[model samples]
Target: MTMHIDAGPRSSIALTGTEFAELDRLIFEDDDWWAMPSAEQAALRHRFITAAVAHHLEHNAAYRTFAESSGFTLADLGAPGSLVRVPQFPTRMFKRVEVRSVRAADCDVFKSSGTSGTQSMVWRDEPSLERLAGSLRPEGDIWRTLYGDVDLDDDGQMVHLGPNRREADGVWISYIMTLVEMFAATRSYVADGVLRLRDVVRDLEGALADGKFVCVAGPPVFMAELLRHMSDNGVKLSAGDRMAVITGGGWKKNESTKLDPDRLRSLAMDTFGLASAQQVRDVFNQVELNTAFIECEHHRKHVPPWVEVIVRDPRDLSPVPAGQVGLMSYLDPTARSYPCFLLAEDFGSAETDNCPCGRGGTTVHIDRRMRTSSHHGCALRLAETVRTD
Candidate 1:
């Protein structure tokens, strides 16, 4: 595999984790996750109001019916936060309408994974992808700081473990890889890694042996297989090499639906080797976006106020009081080229409540609804995190 190292740092405005934590505190303090001082964020909200009104008037038959019955016009939402009063377009809209603010050529892109013939969710990541992509850079510095700088032979290699070969809307992994490319040569799952799981580990062992050690990311099922393959091959990564096993998506049915970290590690211990797997951390992300909320050692998908989250009733679309599990949505005013505020079918709860993290924000708890079935998969969108850029 071949790659171009991104030098020491990508930008002058780069922030280490601590600096980002401070910035996150400053910018994200109260109810300002999507409320940035930038004119760009405000403009995007205005554009959304206009587009939503137009949709209500023209294409959105369901919205038009709702508006006509309620005496709400397409122009009713000219003010920000007005959409909150109206019933959200049902999560089923994706299966029925091309519910986009702009044309494919005009707006940013996101895609959805096809459930087992039941639901169609938008997995669009193109919008706000740059914001999410930039978020990962600060994390790179976190790695450099937490684990002292590791010397690489320059042309390092990696084995990525997810649905990245084709663009099927796995946005979180896409940004994760983009962040990783800054440090090493990335060997793709489709292009270079083996079609057979064991063979992939053999290739990784070979890369590490050749002094081109790499990083890896994937779902627990696939990653476990590869880790086992590595164990069978008697492989071990060096100190300079890094790997983070991400619990980015929903659980695999007919398998374990539990989220116990110890059980997850125990299942893959013999294969990936627990010591090596310890480096495999969890990154939280949303398939619909570019900015990812990462996980700390506590397994929490931490968020700053820049990425706004809204938990509402799936039946009528009202923001549920904190601590109640509801359908999760996001408002990313930072994304300029596409729709900034997006309502998704993600299931989680919000907490205005305090946290032990020394930050003032909410911690999301995933309820595994999307993976349940098409009907329930349309229930809520659980935001996943970083790796794709």
Candidate 2:
């Protein structure tokens, strides 16, 4: 079967059928691809990113104009350092314009959760959606590494703290959370804009009694609220090492209810009777990017070999030294429906050192979102065109 489904304008610069199949095999089929040598991984990333950029430049008119204005040509992507020269649209651009390499009618649009009446709409075609589904499946090597000896398919149950998939159709985080249902039996606790805390407690208690492994996942804020509710009612379950708490989406804009990572993990451990901190792992992703960065046992969010992450100075968009906090940017080759190279409105740092968990690639550390007034560089310039165009 052809892995790529392109329903938009065809381009000669795009990856050919054979090339796409090879790339897909390396990423989704080859088990040892993540453990490859750093040099080899970099070479693969360079090749894939070059093709992806070329494809987008030919198919996306807005992106092409932006690249031309920035004086970034195909020649600029020759060196490893040249990856930074690729023109990047600010993630906010998605809110202002429909940035797509595929036909609007041929893609599913996912919207980010926002209260400001402006939400980012990300387009994902069939191939792009398939890549995402493959990345999040629990049978992958990364998932096995994080969840040793815990089988979710046979003896596990998922207790999600968000709405079901149908209720969260276009909402990105909730929709992603529900995707785990495909692997394990799942029950959602939030419905009709209310968290059914009693239902969650009852199911968790039942799982504890039955001795079945449980994977509880949702936004950190919702998880925190559940933890607090259990603590207040003195309802504790002895799930010791039989349960895992997976939190994602952060405590987005919930400043008053925010709990730092350490505090959140501590609460989960104490409330759920988990034996170690390793059972509480966090996941990181955004609507624009197709890949999800999952935390290993050592608490580092491992960046896969298929993507490149850079921390850039917010003022001038130059690359920052490793471990220095700045605006987070990404070169995501998996997103073929759009130019996934983005200058995001997030503040974070990244390091390429070998992690204690035996992962050899880069590990990203996200700090917080950049203030709206702090937007700069290509993002700011792109916003100017939003008014003129």
Error in Å for residue 284 of model 1: 3.3
Clashing pairs in 2: none
In candidate 1, which residue ranges exceed 4 Å CA deviation?
Answer: 1-87, 107-109, 115-127, 138-157, 163-183, 191-194, 206-213, 231-242, 254-261, 266-278, 313-318, 334-346, 352-360, 370-372, 375-389
For model 2, what is the error of residue 131's alpha carbon versus the real structure, in angstroms, after optimal superposition? 1.0
lDDT of 2 by residue, 75-128 (tens): 988887678888888988877777778777768889775534456778888788
Q: Pick by TM-score: which candidate is best?
A: 2
What local distance difference test score does each model get?
0.47, 0.77
Question: lDDT for model 1, on a 0 to 1 scale?
Answer: 0.47
Which tens-of-lDDT digit does each residue in 1-389 have in candidate 1? 21111111211212223433433443333332423333444344444444434432443343455557877665566677565544444444544444433233444434344444433333232423444555655334323332235553364555655434354243333434445554456555533223355546676657656655355655554555565556666765543324334444444333344345556655554444334444555555544444566554455565544555678887887788877988877654343333334566567886643445344455676654544344422001211221211
Per-residue lDDT of 299 in model 1: 53
